[model samples]
Target: MAELHGTTDDRNEGDASRGVDRTLSAVLASGALGHSERRAKLLRYLVARETSGEGDKIKAYAIALDVFGRDETFDPNSDSIVRVEVGRLRDGLRIFYGECTDPDLWTIDIPKGTYRPTLTPPRVEPVSPPQPAHLNRWALIILPILVVLPLLYYAMRPAPAPEPTAPYPVLRIAVMPFEAAGDHPNLEKVAFGLYTELSLDLSAYPWIAVVSPLDPNEIGADYALKSQLLWQGDNLQTNSQLISLPEERLVWSKSYSIPTTVEHIQDTQLQITSGIATSLGSENSISPDLIVARNARNSKPNLEGFLCFISTYRYAVEPTRTEHLRLRNCLEDAVDAFPEFGEAWAALGVLYMDEVRFGRNPRPGHDSWAEARAAIDKSLELAPLRNAPLMAGVVLSVQAPVQDLERARQLGRKLMELFPRHPPTLALIGSLISEFDGRWPEGHDLVQQAIALENAPPSGFFITPAFFAALQEDDAAALAATAPLTTRTSETELLLKYLAAARNGKTEMMAEQRVLLAQKDLSSDADLVEFVKNRRFHEELEASLTSQLEAAFLVKADE
Candidate 1:
């Protein structure tokens, strides 16, 4: 066995500085070249490459193969050998960085597609200091579960039933984006599909509240009565999203990047959903009827119906009409096969809402609002506390009579109370507070949290956070917050920085922004809004800034 060794003098160094040395030492000791004589040769290769800054996977592999020459070609197919050794190396590097004392020392990261080391500056630690006291208390409390039988018993005890007279508030939950596996072309679709299915499955639990992803308008709301779930792909090859509710900490996380068959997907879904149900302290399992409802054929008709429903509910954002029609037809077929399906009925109602919202004419003699009301009513009749009816209630509140608003508000509050951390509920409540109640700060916080939970790697929901921050007149905060997003462009950042400067009364910042914006040819309101939102600036600022820019440009154009 290779002995792990480190210099004692390194411990006396500051954390950052020590970390760098430890990392370098670990890399040297990784035994990458081979097990015997080749180990020294590998080290030499690494040293040479590091010194020259020209290390790569091919070179590393070639060196390793050469060292083991004629005995056996370096077997790249040996999963166990590669994984175990690489894992050890990774652990060593982690420990080195984690214990480093100096913040300025550059660290080496092994990038994919090459064995070469890439030198990068250390990550900036978040400004918030650790809650040592709280963490210590938690650690102490968690320790000794094995010896403390009574505490273990108490910890494992089922939650007591609520009193009959006491109203049980509806639970609300947010399902973060799920991580995908590998470079699959349909990775996004898979994540979205999982999200949709999980949302549907959870919707069936009467005691558990479910939130839809359709409502992006209400992202920030009170976090007093919610829980969050984070979903991600293992090994960063798949998809992942984090979920958090107000007041409550994270309750569940899942990664699904391992190679899986169809059965595995179903079983994993069941296990995860079951875990979530348990976390919510649900006494009852999902209804067998709901399970049966999911068994319909994956035909075009079913797909169309789902599409129509989604299109209607998401009409405000204007999804592609081609996709919308395709989904609508699929769902319609689903309904045709299962006329008694409560979810189908509820979705049909949402589809009708879409038609009205988008001004799409229905087949002869179909009244969109009337059909919507009927479908929702049927869904409620079938599954009173299920997610579909709850969603229908939300839709009704927006489209129905003033009296229905009270019912919608009541249902909304109930859903929020049950699933307080749910993204859709947060978004809904935030929207209500912003548009109806004029509680901007409260609404802003809710929306911000929701966006954090849903936005993924390549395509993020940027506008919501930017607009909310803009409302607060905190452009600098918005710019700083959005600086790390991979999907946003430099021009977008520059525009936001300019807006922040304008809001902060800094003309120099605005001048810098103008140059970048001009260079990028992104002078339109749409472009400005995209940049502002990506930076979490206010949406209204787009028009206001455009006017200012046009006036400024006119002066320049004349001069």
Candidate 2:
């Protein structure tokens, strides 16, 4: 590392220091680096350390520990998190200063191969010859008029009406009465039964409103789920398709087949209905997919409130500071515009809880917990049966400072009884019990059932199995369980792979996992421990896993 060098005698050190401070603040506030909180924090930390005369001692390990929350076990040789962030920081500073309006602003730079940041005071520009005295007077007179005319026009003009708060129209899905291909006496009854069952099952989803026995010309429904049943070689076959009503486009289609028998009749109905509900309404389902797709091309203001749900869904998938702020603002606006929108309130509650968990609070003294509890309360009061509010209440009960695991369990039981066919709900509650409460076999069974119910299971459906496998010390089973998530780079996926590899003595694979884990902004073993803690696991499992990881990876906690 290099020490800070003194500037030339052209300006006093005090002037240079003040200029650097101003420049740092401007860059930090600027949007040149997009909204990456990691890069912003890195920039601020580096500048603060350099200015405080700690530049020479600013090693990668120290940077990781202080800025990135790494523990003492952080090994600069193995972890590239510090180096990768510094590289990005260097590029971001170049772009910031390159597009700067004030070319004379002092800039901070982390030179290649060194963690120490160098501050370069802006060079003095050659002075232009003074304008003529009459030209300066005329320019001063014109400039005031230019500014005052705009201000006076604004002051004189009538204030426009506030944009009407358009109610967020929940996406409506109508389950069309099914048509029968065969003329069996029971076929019409079976088709009607399927329609009724499917509609009732889909109503459990919080994201969409469900309607049944839809008329083909229904005006309000956004999507139509049409199904047809027939006898195929002594088996009952049900075919279904989801169509976007406005565009009349087929969004998704599927067919399910089951043995034809008196006992199999209800099971067949359940099979087809669970598939449709999971495909259309579960997490990572077609509803959010359609909303995101449409919102990409359409920028009308009416749907902004509607898009808040989509923002929350996307943020849950990939949590970045930018996404968090965007979702938070969107949800806030949504609730403010329509206080009675219980779903939006529920989503807002979830967002607040996330702010607490992720440490993404917008400012000091934000009291995210209080905000979450209030939002949850309002949502429950308004939409008690809605999934979002119910789930939010369940989550808050467990995670808040005054823990209520029993209340969470009660809410989980209520969800299970209410929405037995809802796959994501089942998986979530199952995983919550298994991981948070350490109820192993029972919770694991529920997740397996959820998997069986889903046509296209999400990665979350497999997490419980992986955890179970890891606990059993069956690394191969754990790896196989998480195979569907091979392409994902989430911290959970990396941690699972690391655990599997480390436990099985797979040095080559463990090293590969370490390389990726190192890039997750986690500097040491304790950082991973904190990540696990954020998952809100049961105390027993958390302590056991922490110890196992420490021993398996040969990493020590910071003293």
Cα RMSD to native, each candidate?
Answer: 18.2, 26.1
| Each prediction's whole-model lDDT (CA) | 0.47, 0.66
lDDT agreement of model 2 with the native: 0.66
1-559 in candidate 2: lDDT tens per residue? 1234444435765777788889887776654443345667778888777777777788898888988788999997566567656754664565567556677688677755588888878888789998878798799779999999999999999998765232122344666767888755445444554555466556554344454422432222456788888865567787888886656778778787776653455455455556655555443334443232110111122344644554455455457777678778888887887777776788888888877675565557788889999999898787776566778888888778777889889888878666654556767888888888889877886776555333235676778878777677555776666565563446777787777766666767767776777776655777888888776678877776676678655732211
| Alpha-carbon runs more than 4 Å astray in model 1 | 1-191, 199-272, 275-318, 358-367, 399-404, 451-559
Q: Give RMSD (Å) of candidate 2 vs. truth.
A: 26.1
Question: lDDT per residue, candidate 1, 153-267, as tens digits?
Answer: 8789998875433223233454544534445443455556556666656645543434343332232211112222232432222322224443344445555544333344555
Candidate achieving the largest TM-score: 2
Per-residue error (Å), model 2, residue 519: 3.6
Stretches of candidate 2 exceeding 4 Å from the true structure: 1-302, 360-362, 555-559
Cα miss at 366, model 1 (Å)? Answer: 5.5
